[model samples]
Target: MSRKTFIKGTLILTLAGVLTKIFGFGCRIFLSRSIGAAGMGLYQLIMPVTAVCYAIGIAGPEVCVSRFCAAYAASRDHLRARHTAVFCFGMSMILCIICTVLSYMGADIIAGYIFHNPHVAPLIRISVFSVPFACIHCLVCAYYISKERTVIPAVSQIFEQAVRLGAIYIIVHIAHNKGEEITAAVGVAGLVCGEIAAALLCAAIVLTGRRKNIRTTRHPGIEVKQIIKTSIPVSLNRLALHGMQSLEAALIPLMLTVYGYSAQHSVAIFGILTGMAMPVILFPSTLTGSVAQMLLPSVAKEQSSSDKLIKSSRMALVFSLAFGFICIIGYTTAGAVIMAYVFDEPKLSGYIRIMAWLCPFIFINTTYKSMLHALGQAGRVLLNSMLSELITIICIVFLIPRMGIYAYLLGLLASQAANSALSICAFTRTVSRITTHKPLRS
Candidate 1:
């Protein structure tokens, strides 16, 4: 968790993220061509549900594991760090298993009622199986991240994306050869395959690595009470945020319909925005995302040192904003060409360019929230995030019907701007308190 180590971890994860994005773009291209925009839209509808499930099962536990593991490892308490990983892994696995069962059983209900589209039920059923594997992958990655050992996590990330695109290509080819229609369900199947592959790889590494390291005697241990106390609030905050996000996502196409587009056209437009344009705009965030992720463990480790924490936070914020502005310039100039040529969706160029304005806010928010979480400000993160989502929802409900998709874009930009401002204010206030008083303990 030294500054050098933090930079090294960020570089490793950034490289991995870039490779993953490459493979992911390939997968997306194939899916968009094979199943079309409406199909991608149908597939995107289920993503929020999976995200909610991830929040419920893994998000809180991952944060807790990273924070606690970093603290324990810094104290040279390897035994406790190992135990924390195991405990969180077990807890997350059970929760994910329950989510899998419920999602599978209730896929029809969710698609028909929540999404108001029965066609996505099959995708839902297929996609839910990825949750347990994803939980496993993330928890293992969290542990390694805490140890500042990015090699395993980085490798697993690339391996997963490679396997996913490969699986999708093969499955879609087989289906085409068999004279069967290709659909978004194939895309969901590929996702599950990728997760399974990544989880197995991580599990293998952890098992082999632990053989010589685990000790027989117990030392001062991390208690279940401590884990719950840290994880539950974080979990609830994430659950609420993700729940609101899910609602926002679901309401988009529905609101678009109210804007005068036919059902099919509305869904297709939704697909283009979420699946195509959004990805292109967010492509540069891999660097910021990597920095933010590495910052979490480092920040957690340095939480007792006000000077170091403040310095790191300031550096992250500045880097993210500077990089984001550069992205805005690149996207404003070349984004249209990328979208038009890459996806063969010339219509997406406008969306991409328009959404380019979100880069600074999005990038800054990424780093700020990570540092906030590291500082045990999950409640602030939750509140700021909720306010953003609420703004988007309000716009979707009232404005989309009048101004069309442009209104939604405006809402997104405004919301991210608002969230970024709020996050900065919170960080400033918290760190000012630290500077004036004492460093806060996570």
Candidate 2:
């Protein structure tokens, strides 16, 4: 794609992201208010598991499809692009189905042994239902994104958020009308419904819009091998990262209890940090994410240039740094006010303020990882991520008892800074050596 087309696609994604974020914030505010911190904690507790499952089932394949399809589509080999999608989609469907069955069957072990809460069992079962839907939706969205038709994906995102909110409103209040308090299962039901709607929407677009002239037969064996080859490394990289994150989620609340706090209080505190403050801090990251989305496929093209890669990297860097510092100033200036005004959690200003230092590095880290992944440096991405998460996990294990939540706050800053620095250094070296020769896209 030309630079103009890339910018157009990024802008479309950014606009859609902004709207989705707004609707998401609305859902958060209302959900928190209706269900209270305990309920929010319940939902937050399940997020790490959700992330892990989604990473294994969808994130890797979706990214592989996006990057490889764009590579194929750029050469005008539309048949190969279709084949990539089919192979990845089939892979995702099988994995997600297996995940769903295991999650449902082992919910008791996960809730009892892993999370130390029995109520979480039902919520896990409910949330697992969304995995298949989300996996299929991701593959479909990847195909459209590879074609640079951002409008369809954008519409699907908005539609999903709207459906989630509407479903939450109805599901939560129906239980209320029956004199029952809102449950985490109900919250997850909303997510499942939304995913199903989104899956259907994207499937309609991809299946109905195919041109008749495109080839009808593709070598499933060859394409499947190619897709898995690209996807497995990315999958393992993300799986390791998310697996550590899930471990961190379980550890955070447990370790906080050593600070002489009740488990309920610790869970509530975790909810505030993960569910409330972190989202606010990461709000502007939507732009970086949009650029990353566009960057992957653009960089995956065989004809992609060294100059173009460097230009995009530098642009993402400047924007991330400028925006990061700008956000730091905003959070430092009125974090308390914003928290109070937005999520009604005024006390979390300290967490937000402390985490402000992570903005630039975190944002820049996202762009670098995307560029590196498309550049076929999955091992480097995995190493940087593992190192970062390792640092955070180590700190949580050793220091949360002595320093309490402040330990986590400092650990996050240190980890993001470490990850970002490593990625930038790797990218810089890769760029310098490849200045006179094209880096391998695959």
Candidate 3:
């Protein structure tokens, strides 16, 4: 976790991320053209279930495994680190299994009752199968990240995206040949295939790789307890955040309807914003996201050194600010052109420009949250996130009906700004206390 190693890992991850995003954009553009906005809306509607599943089964364990495994490996306790991964994997698998069962069983109710769109039931059924595989993919990646082995995870990412793009293309091509109408389920099927591919690759590497020397007969009872203890708060935080996001997703179209648009039109608009404009706006986050990925484990490993933590935090903050503003300028200049011509969605141009302001705050918030997680401030993170989502939710509920989509954009800006301010204030206070040799408070 030296500075040089951190930089190298960041570069590797950033490269991998760029490739992945490129592949992903290919799939996205294909889907948009093939299925159109309404179809993409159906696909986006079910994302809440996917996100909730991940929050339940992957997010918390992934963080705990990365943080604790890196900590153990720093102490040269490879056995403990291995045990942490195994235990977390087991817990995550159980949760994922439950999630899959519930989702599959209740797909009809979930789509018809919750989302008010029964057309998404098939997509939900197809999407649920990917959760367990995604859990496996995330935990394995977390383990590799803890050991500072970015190559395997980076490779897995590219492999997954390639498989996804290929699978989607093949499925759509076959359907077209058969004169069948394209649906969101085709996209969901591709997602499932990609997760399965990545999971199998990661599992194979871990099984065949040389960790034999670290094998032990000792039970991991204490480690399991520690993992659970650390994971619960993080898990709840993720679950809450995803839950709010799900609520927002479900409510957006409904709120838009209240704003005088037809149901179909509202859903189509939702699709354009989420699937088209937001992607272009958030594309540059690949770099910040990679840095955050590497920063969390590095910060965890160096938490004992206040100076190093502060330095790392500063570096991440500065980079995010500079990179985010650069992206703002780039998007302001080219975003409209990209959206209008590339996606063939002329309507998205204004939305992209408006959403471009989200870049700096979004990137900075990501880095600060990673630092907070390394500081074991999960509760504070949860509080800030809840407040952030609450603002968006309020706007969606109250303002969207009166002001239309512009209200939602305003909410996004306001909420993210609030969350960023809160996270920076808390992160600064926590780090400054460490510099003062005082106990850190959540």
Best by lDDT: 3
Alpha-carbon RMSD, each predicted model: 1.4, 2.0, 1.4
| 196-311: candidate 1 lDDT, tens digit per residue | 99999999998898786746875556678878877876888788888987888789999989989998898899999999989888888999999988988888877667788778
Task: Itemize residue pairs with steric clashes in candidate 2.
Answer: none
Which candidate, 2 or 3, would have the higher lDDT against the true structure?
A: 3
Scored by Cα lDDT, where does model 3 land?
0.89
TM-score, each model?
0.97, 0.95, 0.97
Worst 10 residues of 3 by lDDT: 213-222
Please count the clashing residue pairs in each candidate, in the order shown: 0, 0, 0
- Higher-scoring candidate on lDDT, 1 or 2: 1
lDDT for position 191 in model 3: 92
Q: After superposition, how far is residue 213 of candidate 2 from its true place, in Å?
A: 5.4
lDDT of 3 by residue, 1-442 (tens): 8878888888999899999999988988999999899888888888889989999898889999899999988989887788788889999999999999999999999888888888888899999999999998999999999999999989999999999999999999999999999988888999999999999999999888856555657864436666777788788889999899988989999999999999999999999998888877777888898899998899887777888887887887788789988888888887677766888888888888889899999998999898898888888999999999999999999999999999999999999999999999888888888788888655
Off by over 4 Å in 2: 211-224, 302-304, 436-442
Q: Which candidate do you rate higher for lDDT, 1 or 3?
A: 3
